[model samples]
Target chain A: MTLLHSRRQKEIRKRLEGMRPRLYRVAFAWTHNRSLAEDLTQDTLVKALQAARQLRELESLDAWLFRIMSNCRRDHFRNQVSTENVDNYDLVDERTPETRSSEQQLIQKVRDSVEALPETHRQTLTLVDIEGFSYMETASILEIPVGTVMSRLSRARARLRKLLATQHVDVRGNDSNARLRRIK
Target chain B: MTEMEHITEEMLNAFIDQELADNDMMHVYLAMSKDPDLRDRVCELRANKELLRAAYRQVPAPRKYQRPPGLLPRTAMAAGIMSLGVGALLGWYAHSFSQSDNPPRTVARAYQTFDSKVKVVFHVSRNDAAAFAQILDEAEALVAAEDDKRSNNSVRIVANGDGLFLLSAKASPFKDRIRILSEKYNNLVFAGCSQTQKRLQRERGLSVDLLPQVSTVNSGVFEVLRLQEAGWKYIPI
Candidate 1:
């Protein structure tokens, strides 16, 4: 590599290292798989390096990197693959057994339930729930109107609650009929 | 207004994230006073939002620049062009090549649709039996609710390793509930991990029932990838 090129590469690596955890988290939220998230992060950095010139005068590097991560996630989904794998991403440790197993179960149950959501709803949830992006920011990233982001997030949360409630019934030892009778 | 009619998930998130306008905040506050369910829902969503953010606190960033695979020898081009009085030509070539060498436009376009969907996976290891049961119950409930709300809802539940426990009739904690959920929501699918089941049976003498609703896949990681490809959002449990 030329001396100039080598210098540029070092600068890029420094920037990437600074943003590694955030990028991984965004990709993880997008793909929900550790390995896929890693691959996506790597891909995003490669593309970012190939295109850093376009990012001139950007206010937030975090948002820009997130934008790139978001795009990589979309591309993965567009390819028509199933995301039903057990996330073995060695990054986060499994929940310890000694902790509130039932509550942890509830959390996992909610996570799995959210996993089943439609694509748009899922994206909305991740932006609003996971990344804590504002409605306007989510709208900009999603290329949707702010109103749509609001409506979608509302619906997604409502659906998530209902899902959690239903799953709670099963874990509590009541069948559907029994649970309905109790509710009625 | 009814108590259920107050601040919604969107409104509350906007408020918490400080995205809502003053007028919108007034409306949400008014609704919050009247609608207990809405209030509770907002709280739940807010908590979930916080949890998600905390979980993803350290996401990484992309690299700044990368060198291309190959380039023409600059010395040779410079020598040939100088004799031809083509200093301008050589300079233009070098500039254009450098720009083309790392096309930022393509990268920008590539990520134009950065966050189009949500992706999630359920991780149930062999030891976490209780968690497995709860996840299945949640899956059934989610499916049932979706059945009520939409005419054409699509939800897939892939069970791997101990997750297979939820699908088996003999050991399932919520077998009957799952059946009911499956009956009403045709979109609800239960997938089993072929490798996990094989290992269980051969290594531990545990029998795994790969039921009709529970289709076996190559691997859990591949299943997650497959679902993402099909445009299903993912949340890891």
Candidate 2:
């Protein structure tokens, strides 16, 4: 309507752009497939832009975007969940046993362990641990009770610890060629 | 010091995650200090969370987003940001006026009035009553002078920070005068900055109630920039 209004709209557009990588990481965690994750991220952003006016508070932005992403991810799997290829999950370590740097292997193991978790628990864990969302915000994003979020997160962590046998994360990407760079 | 048997895994998780309330948080601290095993268990859960956080932060190389050109280009109701020279400013002014709810003749009449007057923006970011008095004096005089000639020229007062007092419903001393002047001048706008309002609430726990006649913008500084970019004379008070 006015340049001032356009500039304000552009501010929102810029914010959405800044959120892309974070959205992708969450999406990737959900789908365990890069392209699907990318598509989910892209769709979530486009939907967010279209529905930007509906968002009233900036403090709730992370929860709001993740909610949109959750919807998009749900919509994607709604019709395709059963028919989707199980082997398409390429989260396995890409390197040969000799060539595999332990860090890459650990990264793959983390992805696999997380994927093995129940969907609700995995969502709670990633939202809290990875995105640093507070328990309340995670509850809102996942549309569950705070008590439920805490329980799911607790179960997820316990299962992860058992899966990895209480392993601590110490491996940095010591080798450049064998490294998985930090994303989001 | 609390008993080792008292700490549940949920409370330990909440404590390690810093999700516990202040009182319970202290309770966990007391228990952990009293019991070595409790501390060790909290440390383990904390470490596991850190591990997940770290591992997920790493990933394979990403394919560039094939974002189509003009992913969010201008819509019918909105336009792109245009460089405003002397002519461009008037054009944009007229363009904006045209889009307003005013009738066709009013748009033309308002354009003429805008062209004749030097548009003004008064910026206030302080609670100094003296400065506010000066701003009110200058603003009232400017608009009243234009009223003598029967012109509805535009003026804006963009306030943020402590300057928001000028628009505060209960705090503003010149509430009656502002209401009177606003009623007299068709295009005089009083805008409060939302950023400052949010900051005040978050930091100082103040809930600001603006005067009924005033509107709000995302940022007061941004409003100043908007007016100046559109060729309005900026007078910071």
Candidate 3:
């Protein structure tokens, strides 16, 4: 029995270790900052390890770790203020127009649009669309109903389309006013 | 737009994602066949999903992060093996090498006496091809710097999890490069975990054949622990 228990424990550790990259990737996507993502992943791992005895079903480990990560993300942002100084709108693009490829610009635009989404919608879209989690799995991770997941995902996708379309217009030599309109 | 009234945007989204029930999917398909507008909406939603996926695919995880100290006693030992004497060294070496199935061809030059001994273990856990390449570059640079200093350095790269690609016989693109490195540096060791291999074989039904130069470790985590126990630096790549 002791040997079996030890083997089970080893299995759990290996599984958790294997999940590190995935956990880190999701955390990174949510936070959009490397250090915060690392902190969240580390916290989630430590918390999961400490609470291993509470895990009744090994099948639910993915959801459990994600729940911990979601909570960690919530707590982290709760205490912290946004880094952006909203009034300072004169931030220059470091890459000059000639140097920036069109494909790179489009990718950057899409990235910015996704990051601009509301937290709930962004998380939902990321899990459902990018991470390819089922609605039920996403709901379990976020501690929300499946209905809520569906609604959030739909809204996120719709908003992303609008945001991308608006950006496409702005990218076509539109002035600052057009850019502001798109942002609005 | 009038034709799309029967199918809500959310329903269309669900249909595109295949999240609809079989009956609902059939309904949507029937509706789409009659309605070009509805079909266009579905196509547009799919395009959006594909675009979103493409954009996010560019967002790679950060190269390095601070891995928290493992909480379990065994895990703590695995993550941090400190101040082990010569006795522990010999025991670990023998225990590691004596494992059945695939055994390491040569004992790691870990315990060799040198003027300045620099030991590093690069833990691979992600399938990031670029990151893996970067690790090899860093390893080569370390060797070059150590050589310049006339120091005897040992570098062991342990592959587990998704990083098993570093030693994969069938699918690894880095096999030849790993071979060249081994031939060049007598001090360098490449280790693949038997536990991970067995798990892959059992779960994924993949019988991974490790390259000629690579060695099999009982547990990559434990091998890391043993190396760290004997004054080796631990780095996760």
True contacts kept of 1: 0.30
Worst lDDT run of 10 residues, candidate 3 chain B, spans B80-89
With a 3 Å backbone cut-off (N, CA, C), the pairs that clash in candidate 3 are none
Residue A11, candidate 1: alpha-carbon lDDT: 58
| Span of 10 residues, lowest total lDDT, candidate 1 chain B | B83-92
Evaluate model 2 with DockQ and give the value. Answer: 0.16
Which scores higher on lDDT, 1 or 3? 3
Cα lDDT tens digits for candidate 3, B157-201: 999888897679887889888889999988788999877787788
Per-residue lDDT tens digits for candidate 3, residues A1-184, read 2221365555666677668777877776687666556557766765565456578788988888888889877855642443333322324455687875665676677778888899999998888877788888999999999999988988988888789777872333343323222321
TM-score per candidate: 0.47, 0.54, 0.53
**TM-score of candidate 2's chain B against its reference?**
0.50
How would you class the docking of model 1? incorrect
Per-residue lDDT over A1-184 for candidate 1, one digit per residue giving the tens place of the 0 to 100 score:
2322444434544565556556666666665666777667656754464455566544555567767767877865643354433444456655577863553455455566766777789878887777677777788777789899888887876776677566662323343422222231
Which CAPRI level is candidate 3? incorrect
Q: A25 in model 3: Cα distance from truth in Å?
A: 2.1
lDDT of 3 at A148: 93
**Chain A TM-score of candidate 3 vs. true chain A:** 0.77
- Give stretches of model 3 more than 4 Å off: A1-5, A81-99, A169-184, B61-237
CA error at residue A64 for candidate 1, angstroms: 2.3
**Candidate 3 Cα lDDT to native:** 0.69
